[model samples]
Target chain A: MRTLLTGNYAVAEAVKLSRAKVIAAYPITPQTTIVEKLAEMVEKGELDAEFIRVESEHSALAAVYGAAIAGRRAFTATSSHGLLYMYEMVWWVANARVPLVMAMVTRTIGPPWNIHTDHTDLLTMRDSGWIISMAENVQEAFDLTIQGFRISEEVDLPFTVGLDAFQLSHTAEVVEVPDQQEVDEWLPERRQSYKVLPGNAVTIGNIGPNEYTAKLRYAMAKAIEDSRKVIEKADNSFGEKFGRKYGGLVEEYRLEGAEYVVVMAGAWCGDAKDAIDRLRDEGLPIGMMKIRYFRPFPKEEIKRLEGKEVLVVDRAFSMGYMGIFGMEVSSVIGDVTNVIAGIGGVDVGVEDFEAMFRKFASRKLQRLEWWPREVFS
Target chain B: MLTEVMILSFGGQGGVTAARILALAAVNEGMFAQAIPQFGAERRGSLVRSYLRLSDQPIRRHSSIKKADVLAIFAEKILKIVEVREFLRDGGITVLNAKHGIAEKSYCVDAAGIALSLNLVAAGWPIVNTAMAGAMAKPLEISIESVINAINSTFSGELARINARAAEIAYREVKKCQAGSST
Candidate 1:
């Protein structure tokens, strides 16, 4: 059924439909309503699950990790500062190979105390050995989340579905909610190969030698690589059942026969699509390739942009480094004109993008620069 | 076709609810729609903006509306807001909830006075979002019935009827006037 839902509510619905056995979450802006709605669902008997009310995001993830280790499908959500606070446990869950899913409602980190959308929080955990995927809208938030559980359980790694803070989190749009029976048939009960329950006791988290540490790290790295197949398989299987395919690790939009491509992710990609359509109508060759899964890092997709004018817009910066997304893409694609825009909830729209594309199309852009500075200011 | 509407009002004025209802009305008509509240400190008596977009196809632009095809003001004082004035597209339509005279390409309804007369107050301010929504329907090319149906879905029983009445009165009472009349 088609219903108007915010991005946060869509995630809660996905969690319910996924039939997550345990949910431990601490409230934070943008992500608060997601877990809150889940709690309401559980309390009202709409969803059958244990809603663990944790005082802090650290405890939230820790509780979820405990649940997952005990052979249960666990879920949690946090944003910005809360995500930073959960940093230690974030790495722990991945390294421990606890198959859990978390919703990272990407918000700008503090010092200035901003709660609006940005990629810094999500990008900060990009190297944490977790399966990271971003959603472009409310429907994708729902779809990717259900897929996140499948992907995580397949590889025995945690998954984080990154959603832009207020842009999609609070905004309402039409979303086609899949039927519960259909989703249940698509995603079966999570299979537990190993559990820390009674009678199946095994030595876990013991001190290991340096060589053992190297072996564990190697296996985790190889698991992430091999999980690429599982991710694709889940996406294809989802499309077969749900009629929506998000193109595995990366989604390409109007990239063929285009001279320039704008690379981005999250809800901003929607704006880029509109700008691309407007530019195309005016005889400009431009397209966009949205990196859906940032952790697996779509090397093949980035390589396809070889010998093209690449404009990468990063909503958050890495301080001493250039825009993190631009740096990563440039490292792979060789050269990219980075547009570091919307750092602290600043708005970037179609007009702003039109100007950027015009500069690139006319060869007026000589080097990388922050947007709105080059155009607006 | 896509129509963008920007609603400006004070925090306690139900500006966000107005935007949501308008979007729902559009969606009920089988069109794609989106409603968003401006992200910032939301406090009573403070300036607030809510955006609405209705399209024949899927509405994908998730950014704030920089330019609006239609502008609605619940607080008459918001007319002095240069940013709000600048957001209107060239030759755009505007609906205002004010007692003062209106200008060309604009419609004005005494929505606050109507809300007060109807004894409709939300958070100590006369509720005008519904009335303003009714006034917006004409310029937006949406029916009064559509607005009323959306209002009914948003509220219930007596409150719904009161809002529906507020909207109906505003729809009929809005006056068409010349251009550049200060409220």
Candidate 2:
């Protein structure tokens, strides 16, 4: 339906339609209202899900894990410190391939104690075996939530849908909410566990030999790798079902016949899109490629942006001067020439896009200057 | 031709709801619109920003409206938050929820009074966004019925009727403001 909704609410609706039976979340900025709205849904009998008001993110994911193992679809959400607190569970999520869907309102880590949008939180969890996707706007936020459920369940891996905290979480955008019946139709009832404990009581988190362990580990890797195709198929099916086609794993705008492109995830892409429109008005051939599905690291998918001057905007700095996405993009470009402009900020404004575009237009590697290293020091 | 209007306001005030009504009205006019929330708005006593990205074209990125054709401020206190003015395009309107009046440059209104007269007392507070939206709509040639339809879509049951009425009253208030100034 054409009801207007926020990115957070869109996620909540997807969670409801994903047939998740448990929702465990703690109140955090940007992501607080998502759970709050879910609680209201459960309270009003709008959703049959169990809304677990956990005291901490650690317990929140733990609660979700238990629910998932009990063979019911499960969910949880966190941001910044909350994700850090639950960092330990990330391994569990990956190792278990829990098929849970989480919405992380990506926020900057503290010390300065900021409550704004950034990618550091989600980037930190990039190595987690979850199928990750960052929303470019509310539509993707809504669409990705549905896709996350499908991909995670199909691959039997958990997925984290990233939205720049405060940015998309709070930003209202025209999100085409699918009919509940359509969502229900698209998202089949996910079997929460491999098998129920009908006296068969097989062990989860089972210990194994190195060879056995390796195969299991690769299963997690395989699922993560498999998520790209799964996402593509889901998006294709979602489009067929809902009349909204979100360009599978990555959505490109005006990229054909363009020379310069800037990359970003989450709502920052919105500002980038407008900037592209404005710049295009001025006759700039610049374009934007939004990597919606972040985790299965669609290097081949990003190969389409190859020869163009690429500037990967990493809101969260990787250990090396590049984020996992920027690194992977650069790696995929693989000796192909492109300037990497690494910039970090909470919920980038139009000025940031303008700066990046100017840098790209000139073909300069503005990394050392654009990065926020002085603060990190 | 997507017209995205981002209103930055504080909680307790109706920034999100106001954006919804405006965007909703735009939809009634047959435009595709979406309202998304942002920083400073989720917590009580904090500044909030709700953005309406509308276009004849389908919106692609879920980014904050960097340049607003109209900037609606629901809280007088939050006027300085995040350089909302920077997002204003040339000749765009900036509406503030201020008491008395703003001199120099601004589209000002005491939206509370409009709600009171409309008997939507609960819809009052952060009064300026609605009034500003109400006032700006006419100049932009957006229909009042569109605004009414938007308010109706978001507000459930009785409040739907209430906010729609408030939107109408707000429209007249803006009209009166325009009249008092020019004629």
Best of the candidates, lDDT: 1
Question: Docking category for candidate 1?
Answer: medium
lDDT tens string, model 2, B48-165? 7677767787665554566777676665556445655576787676665554223233565666666656555443443444555676565455788888776666668886776666
Taking the tens digit of each residue's C-alpha lDDT, what string does model 1 give over B1-183?
A: 999999989888999889888887887778888989887557788888899998999988899997789988898788665456577888788888765533347887899999999999966889999999888888887788888999998999999999999999999998875555454
C-alpha RMSD values across all candidates: 2.1, 4.2
A119-238: candidate 1 lDDT, tens digit per residue: 988999988899999999988999999999999998999999999988988888888998899999998998997778878768666898999888998999999999888999999999
**Ten-residue region with minimum lDDT total, candidate 1 chain A:** A366-375
After superposition, candidate 2 runs with Cα above 4 Å error: A198-200, A278-284, A304-307, A335-347, A371-377, B2-11, B34-38, B41-53, B60-68, B71-89, B94-110, B116-133, B156-162, B176-183
Question: TM-scores of the models, in the given order?
Answer: 0.95, 0.85
For model 1, name the residue pairs that clash: B103-B178, B104-B178, B104-B179
Q: Give the per-residue lDDT of model 2 (tens digit) for A271-350.
A: 67878888888888988788887777777878877677777766665665556556768887853223222233344556
- Per model, state how many residue pairs clash: 3, 23
Candidate 2 reference-contact recovery: 0.60
Q: Residue A217: error of model 1 in Å?
A: 1.6
Distance (Å) between predicted and true CA of A342, model 1? 1.5
What's the interface RMS deviation of candidate 2? Answer: 2.8
